[model samples]
Target: MRAAVYRRPGPAAEVLEVVELEPPEPGPGQVRVRIVTSGINPTDWKTRAGYAGRMPDGFQVPHHDGAGVVDAVGSGVAGLAAGQRVWLYLAAFDNRYGTAAEYAVVPASRAVPLPDDASDDLGACLGVPALTAAHCLGGNPEALKGQTVLVAGGAGAVGHYAIELAKHAGARVVATVSSDEKRALAEGAGADLVVRYTDADAARRIRDFANHVDRVVEVAIAANLDLDMAVLGSSGTIAVYAAEGELALPVGEFMKANTTLAFVLLYGLSPGQLADAIRWTSGALAVGALSALPVIPYPLEQVAAAHDRAAQGIVGKVVLRIAGN
Candidate 1:
């Protein structure tokens, strides 16, 4: 198998290298996948750059999301068979082999069957971003119906999925973007309204459109606290996924409004929460409720370049083509 590996964390160019290795086989409750497309998330680059600490294994194949076909199924695994098309999540969490290779072995639970209608490209885009979005939107589609949801950084990978998932759950979505290009992306994802977060009257605009935001899928909580606080409804929840710097809560205002702050870290999600997110995301995919952002493709050999692009926060999904099919 050909895989991209990093022996020690550092710059993508300095660390990532393509190499040949024996393809791994599945263990009990695991499945081996013949990867078709590997998706790069911010986590992929960050981990490769050592942000999350030392690598779990001495060497790493760095990607958690991909779309592939089941090459083999391990003992005790049920409902998944060799040759089944699947999308994988958390493939490299504690394993040295990830979907950045021609093959990857992962727990069966992380390999979800991709719908026949969903392309491999779209399937590759689902894992981290879509699952995180589903979790952030409260993991219950029924609970979101008829509510107004606010998505910060609606042009981002997670935010793009957040907007679509919120809308698919029957919620009216309001997205905040800094640029017209991003506004178009959010709008195309079906956000009911898009407002420039930098606008002087951004909060007022959101308030005018939705009355009050019932839930918030926040990307930069520290940066958008005031904007979020201004439009959040009483008793609303702010589900924060990413933040930079420390945030000092407005204790008095939060107490008065009964605001709930939910921090979402995809890798740290409890099993139950992860399951719910997967179920919801799968359901949404089956119904064609989810759509992929524009994809930027790179060959497996260009893994380092792909990592750099994702780290630069490109507007579309960055995916590595691992197989011709």
Candidate 2:
């Protein structure tokens, strides 16, 4: 089996290499998947560039999400069967083998059944972005019904899913974007209103459009704090998924509005929380409510280029074509 391995963290060209290795066998409660496509997320590149931490093993195959056919199901795995089409999540969390290989072994629970109608490319885009969006939107679908949800970076992978999921939950979705292209992307994702965040009156526009936002799915909390605060309704929650540096809370303002700031980190989610996210994401996928961003593909040998592309924060999903259709 051919795999892309990085023994050390550095620039993509310096570290990523494709080589052949024996296909790993599944252990009890695990499954071996013949990978069709591997999806790249910001976390994938960040880990590779040494932002997250050192590699867990001597060498690492990068990418936590993928779509593939089940080649073998280990003992004690009942729901998944050999030859089933599935999408994997967190395949490289603690394991050395990720989805960047011809075959990958992962816990059976991480491999969710992909609906027949869903494309393999769509399946590969689900794991990180979809799950993070689900978690950020809260667990109960009914919780968002009839409310207004504001999503920052509406054209981003997580923001794209957040828009779709919020709409599925019956929310009036508003998205903030920096350009006309992103505005169109957000609008296509079913947002009720797309506001240019660069506009001087962006907060006013959002507030006028929705009266007040019940929730905010924030990407860059530190950068958008003022705008988010301006449109946030009383008692609303700002669910932050990504941020840098420390935040100086406006205690008085928060107290007056009775607002809450919640942080969502995928890796820190409790088992129950993670389960809820997966369950919600799976349901959304089953009904065709979830859609993938535009995909940029590269073959296995060009994994380094894929990493570089993903690291550039392109508006599309970066994927590696592992197996031909």
Candidate 3:
């Protein structure tokens, strides 16, 4: 298998290279997938740059999300057979090889059967961002009836899906965008109101959009904490998926307001949370309630370029067509 191998952490292009590696076989409770598409996410770049921690002793493949056909199943793996289409998540979390290759092995719990009608490219893109959206929005079996939620950076990868899932769960959505062009994109994702976050009075604008926002699906909590606290209703949940900066929170402010904080990291999601996201995403896809994937495609060899483009901001999900789709 030709795989992207990163030996040590540095710039993506400087550290990552294409190398021929042995294809892995499925272990007990795992499945071997011949990958069709691999999704490039911000975490992929961060991990390649060694943000989470030190690199391990061996060469590491990058990417957590992929769609593929099951080529083999390990012992104890039942109800799945060769040639079944599947999408995977949490690939390469702690001990597994990832999806940036011709084949990868992952726990059967991470692989869910893809619908026959779903595109492999789209299925690949759903793992991280879509799961983040669904989980952050309280992926309970019941719907979010009559709740008002706000999505910060709603046109970005995770934010877009947040808007869709929140709306599908019956929440009234207010999305924040940095530019005018993204306003329509957020609105199209079912946001009832879109506020420009670059305005001088952005916090005030957010408060005006929703008189009482019951939840906030926040991307940049470090940058938007004040706005979020200002608009959040009493006892509301602030689900933060990204806090890109190092700004300190005004603990006094949130404490006074009695706001509940849920800091989420997709890779560390609990098993039940992961299962709920899968069920919600699969249901939404089957009903066409979620929009078709908006993707930026790259070749397998150009993974670095894809990472650079994704880091540039404003680009949608980037996917590599690793094999026939």
If both were scored by lDDT, which would come out higher, candidate 1 or candidate 2? 1
Per-model root-mean-square deviation over C-alphas: 0.9, 1.1, 2.0
Question: lDDT for each of the candidates?
Answer: 0.92, 0.92, 0.83
Order the candidate numbers by TM-score, best to worst: 1, 2, 3
Instruction: Give the TM-score comparing model 1 with the true structure, all chains together.
Output: 0.98
Count of clashing residue pairs in every prediction? 0, 0, 0
- The candidate maximizing TM-score is 1
Which candidate should be chosen as best, given lDDT against the real structure?
1
Model 3 clash tally, residue pairs: 0
Q: Each candidate's TM vs. the true structure?
A: 0.98, 0.98, 0.93
Off by over 4 Å in 3: 141-143, 200-209
lDDT of 2 by residue, 1-325 (tens): 9999999999999999999899899999999999999999999999999998785578899899999999998999999999999999999998999999999999998999999999999999999889899999997678888999999999999999999988988999999999999999999999999998879999888878988999999998888989999999999999998868888888999999999999988888888988988888888888999888899999999999999999888888999999554
Residue-by-residue lDDT tens digits, candidate 1, 31-145:
9999999999888899999998885567899899999999999999999999899999999998888889999999999999998999999999999999999999999999999
Clashing pairs in 1: none
